[model samples]
Target: MFKPFINTLALSTIAIATPLIIPIIAPAHALTEAQVLERLNGIPVFTITDDKGAPLLGSAPQKGSEKPPQVLLFFLNPDDAQATLTQIQKTNPAVGSKARIVIRSMNDAYEVIKKNQDKKDIAFQIVPAKASIESARTILTSQGKPADKLPNVPVFFAIGGKDKEQGLLTLEQNGKQLVPFFFDQKDLQSLIDRAKQQQPDVANATKIQVTSLFQVLDSMVATKDNKPNPDTERFTFVPSRNAFEYVVKNQPATTPAPATKK
Candidate 1:
């Protein structure tokens, strides 16, 4: 079925092995790039480029724009959508990030990510990226991809309206284990404030090895070597404004709540 199996849209995805087995594998690809992009939620900014690559509509924020959308990107390794949610809350705290955040990892899970959405409060809106390398490169550059800095799985990006990577945040934990670390609100706050700092130009984004969230993002994407997992995560639904009341009640004013969550 590999050849002449389906349409010309080449579909490739990364998957995690679960304990359970499926009696029958589904037809078509498990993670379709188009389907993933449809599930995202937020202010919903996009670029409608012409055939020659000119913007028709739906552009991102440009420099010197005060109201530009704040965007954060999480590149997850093990690529579990459920685990993806916890990491976002811990690092970015969905409730107060004034910026829009998107988590991209290995594709191949719809129900898995969706189930988590029903139960927990995913602080920010989620959106999948273009599954393939070429398409993804286009979206990332709709702003600009720091091919020099970010590299591989678990890369985080803090982007402006024009889609430039202002602050890139990366994480090391494999999907869900992020719970214990982020549980402490005070500690988490410190990291959030730290994300605001500007990163220096990566000497060689492609050659860089990832140890921290920021370094990985700055290195990996800059190289443009690794292709993002096809099943990029996107927000299907978002929480209401009432969501942040809990944070306000518990955290001190020093809390770096850049924006409100759900």
Candidate 2:
């Protein structure tokens, strides 16, 4: 399982006291701790535990599955969080439930994810990262996203679905590179339009605004261990770190497909 957020408590010790000291602009109206926890109700989650009955690392079940895309909002309260989630859903029904939206930094357990299932209004679920600071850093580093101040609210990721082998092949055959963007509403629409037409996974769709963000992302990741490169498709977006993993992370675990064959 891609479980890291829950157990990142160890890394939480590393904190930014004067967050705004840097020039990085953060996300708007991200969830507060309590709100982050509450949204987890009923969404599927991936947890990491030791042999003992202690919770270690875990991730909210907010994979880049469904249709339109999946968004991960930071630092928002309940009301604000709901507003952003609702607005995104108003997209074409073809993309409505296609998106999986979530918030993080809730009470480090795995209950709210189940709550989403019981109440049953949200088409997709919101997940909480028991400890998200380190996970944020990891995601930024891995995907070549910058680190000024990761957004706390109104932050979102637009994820699309895949038909498995065919999707991976498309990326490979097309020589496509997945781009990640921190977009405002207007740019977000640009991404949505391309995603709707091509239904690319988030990375692929980001190519539309490639020059804007990739330059920074490439630099950001260059300082890390696993920066994006050729293997991005094979390791990050393919069978190992690719779209298939996104689908499997939230769904019930199944035997992993063999590395090579489709």
- Give Cα-based local distance difference scores for all models: 0.25, 0.28
The 10-residue segment with the lowest total lDDT in model 2: 7-16
- Candidate 1: lDDT over CA atoms? 0.25
Q: What is candidate 1's TM-score against the reference?
A: 0.17
Error of 2 at 66 (Å): 46
Q: Each model's TM-score, in the order given?
A: 0.17, 0.21
lDDT of 2 at 253: 30
Candidate 2 TM-score over all chains jointly: 0.21
Best by TM-score: 2
lDDT of 2 by residue, 81-148 (tens): 34444555574344434433332222322333323323322222223222333444545666776754
